[model samples]
Target: MARLLYELCGIEDALRFSPFCWRIRYALAHKGLEAETRPWRFTEKEALAFARHDKVPVLVDGDEVVTDSYNIMRYLDHHYPEAPLLGEGMAETRARFFNHYAERTLAPAILRIIMKDLLCAIHPADRAYFRRNREKRLGCTLEAFHAPAQGLDQLNAALEPLRGQLKTSPFLDGQAPAGADYLLFGHFMWARCASNADLLAESDPVHDWHARMLDLHGGLGRNARRIRDVGAV
Candidate 1:
């Protein structure tokens, strides 16, 4: 059996905002890597505890600790060569690229739409602490994100070629959902958190496919105790 000591992450991240971590978690789940998740909330110092390079996605495999989301995904791909994250043909290749682009570029737009100022109405403490900290670290105030994000046009343009693929195929890669699905899933999930639940709720096949990914994984996500338990930490 593959050991359950796979990866670790932060909790409030999904809401507090960290697209990178969410991408890694979904990658792990999609591959069925059965890793232990250690969730660390970053209201303060916890974010740095496992960061080898001062980041959140610190993958702990037994005594080994790997940081960097891309590196983590690479490690999983290398270790579990079966059920490849990259699918088989040109279409699959395109889907993988689409996933990466959508996750990387379109993410900010989705976040801007989600984390809007309706915040003071709910989870004020968490919101306040996150804003203060991200500002200190990124060198900008939370208000920076308030400017009606400017990348959806780019996102829509990027996803244009695949708009047809998504409409025709049930999954991003057609019959089988590949690693790409999880990547995009993380984006949509984060959008939901940031409050743009309407994006996916719109007439997009991505929403239906995301629901299927959840079913394949057997739950909302790899919130395996190791990860979800960190909610309190």
Candidate 2:
């Protein structure tokens, strides 16, 4: 078995935090694949490295630079076919759906809140720096995120389906914490901190599902570092 070298850009707060990166970590752990995790920090130089050098959650299998969560999962599936990340059929499809849904739909809400409310609330001197870094990672105009309102409601709504899903399976894909579970871990990373800080809280299937996922995987890694001591999910 080839032990993979995983490079992650660690950010504990805000939307830029690497929940997506965490998904890859969780998948590596779940697959029982031997690997080393190197936690990287934020800096313009670091951001430039990932962007210019193909960005992160960059999985190094020997010399190959494998990036993107779904793409990495696919690579893993192809190579390590034993404990498959995607199960047989319908289950695998569901995991894929959840992964895409989280990236496409759920992520923007938390991002919007972080961008408009949180970032702007920082000192005026720091906001420009913050916006510049965010735009680099997201490849979008900071002005677009000036209104996080649109992203907020949609995030909550997208999360509604998960509440019902969690009621049935401990993991998003079913009995095992498959690829979707890892993806969800990343998606929920930002909001987890907010509830803890008492800035705001979320309700329902979202909370419950988070509980189950956290219980299974320990906790979402993105916000886990901020724990005064430790956090469950």
Candidate 3:
């Protein structure tokens, strides 16, 4: 059987927007491996019951089932060692840090800016579930929680460390893209695919790096369908 990847999508099946799923998608491309991607949505918990995970991305690799984006990356590297992604020694440790940073800091910041737009993009069947769950976690309604102006400021400030790193190198992992690159790139991809929010300024080095990432692995990110034009960086 072919490797199957369950990924989160929006209203249209083609609109694969989840940051975690994007990480695995890029990881698979980096390994030069292909998997048939299956679109999953917020209300489709039953579809993923076999994986025993509430969230994506779920990777079905023969008899091995992998959940979580970071684990999926590790699994790919372990199984396909020809092109190492997590790097070696201290580099691996740094990638781990990037993974955490993406989940904790970057994802939240972007979500604040694009949550409203995201709601519009997701499947109609998922809106209620998405809103209920998100509002409960956020302690406010989606409209009250979304603050693009504040979100933009927070996002830029939170990106200072990454901005400093990009000043010296083109990618998070020095000259070439790696796990660290994908970790953060997935967040940006989240905003790109779901919202028209202009998250990055043209002068920002991070914007340039994002463009580079989109062009990587045969334009895997660049070619993906988005809800609307995210506007120029």
Predicted model with the maximum lDDT: 3
As a whole number from 0 to 100, the lDDT of residue 181 in candidate 1 is 67
Ranking by TM-score: 3, 2, 1
Better of 1 and 2 by lDDT: 2
* Candidate 1: Cα lDDT at 93: 60
Query: lDDT tens string, model 3, 1-233?
Result: 47999999877888889999999999999899999999999888999999898999999999999998988988898899877889668878778999999988887788889988898888889999998998998899999879888889889999999899999999988898889999889999999999989999999988999999999998999998998843322
Q: Which stretches of candidate 3 lie over 4 Å from their true place?
A: 229-233
For lDDT, candidate 2 versus 3, the one ahead is 3
Candidate 1 vs. true structure, TM-score: 0.67
Candidate 1 lDDT tens digits, 41-139: 444355556544555566776666677665666677777767767544674566556566765666656655554532431244456666776578647
Using all chains and alpha carbons, the TM-scores for the candidates as numbered come to 0.67, 0.68, 0.95
- lDDT minimum window of 10 residues, candidate 3: 224-233
lDDT measured at residue 154 in model 1 versus the true structure, 0 to 100:
43
What's the CA RMSD for each of the models?
Answer: 5.7, 5.7, 2.7
Q: Pick the candidate with the highest TM-score.
A: 3
Tens digits of per-residue lDDT, candidate 2, 1-233, equal 34554343322332233566667766776776667665443333454364355455667776566777778887888887877776657876777777777777867666765554344333344456667877987788777764556666666577667667778876666776677777767756544432332212355655655666666545445335443323332
